[model samples]
Target: MTAWVRGRVQGVGFRWWTRARALELGLTGWAANLRDGRVEVVAEGPRESCEKLLAALRGGDTPGEVEGVVERWSDAKRSMVGFVEK
Candidate 1:
């Protein structure tokens, strides 16, 4: 899963929170801050777990305001190790 999150996400521990959520979901990937003020979250795991993360992202329980979340689904590559904030 690749999700681009927008709105009040930078400099507010969004990446850290995302990493924690991903790790708790047993996912492996990275959440990175884009230069354009968006956070790009990439996770590799079971479909169910990914969906849970997505739900959490849009569930309005995060540190910053998540105006929107645009997600893309794809085949897992099995290349990621642990979740990290990037």
Candidate 2:
């Protein structure tokens, strides 16, 4: 699953947050900041894993509040690389 997340996500360690959570869930993908002040995430794994990642991205059991989450499927190739901020 993929997400084009907006709102007050940038400059708040959103990418770092996602990397940590994704690693915890054993997910593989990339999360980066868009030029338009949004966060673009590309994730791949089992459906359950993807859902968990999305849920965490939306609003995890953390202090950061996710203002909004826009999820969608994408044709991007899955990364065999480790999670990292980009």
Candidate 3:
């Protein structure tokens, strides 16, 4: 799953928070800051875990304001070891 989050997400530890959540969910992927002030999150794991992470991303419990989130689901391609922030 991939998610592009917009709003007050940059410079607000959103990536770190996302990493923590993803790790806690036993997902392996990364959360990165885009040049356009959005955060892109990628996760590979059980569908339930990925869905949970997506829910949290849009659940209004993040560090900053989340005005919008664009989500996409695709086949996992990476053999990631752990969740990271980039």
Tens-place lDDT per residue, model 1, 29-63, is: 99999999999999999999999999999999988
Across residues 20-65, which tens digit of lDDT does each residue of candidate 3 receive? Answer: 9999999999999999999999999999999999999999999999
Per-residue lDDT tens digits of candidate 2, residues 7-86? 77888888888888888888788899899988888787777888898888766553345667899975547646777778
Give RMSD (Å) of candidate 2 vs. truth. Answer: 2.0
What's the TM-score of every candidate structure? 0.98, 0.84, 0.96
Residue 25, model 1: Cα distance from true site in angstroms: 0.6
Q: Which candidate leads the pack in TM-score?
A: 1
Candidate 1: stretches off by over 4 Å: none
The window of 10 residues in a row where model 3 has the poorest summed lDDT is 77-86
TM-score of 2: 0.84
CA lDDT, every prediction? 0.95, 0.79, 0.95
- TM-score sort, best first: 1, 3, 2
Q: In lDDT terms, how accurate is model 1?
A: 0.95
Clashing pairs in 1: none
Task: Point out where model 2 deviates above 4 Å.
Answer: 60-65, 74-79
Window of ten residues with lowest summed lDDT in model 2? 58-67
Which ranges of candidate 3 are over 4 A from the true structure? Answer: none
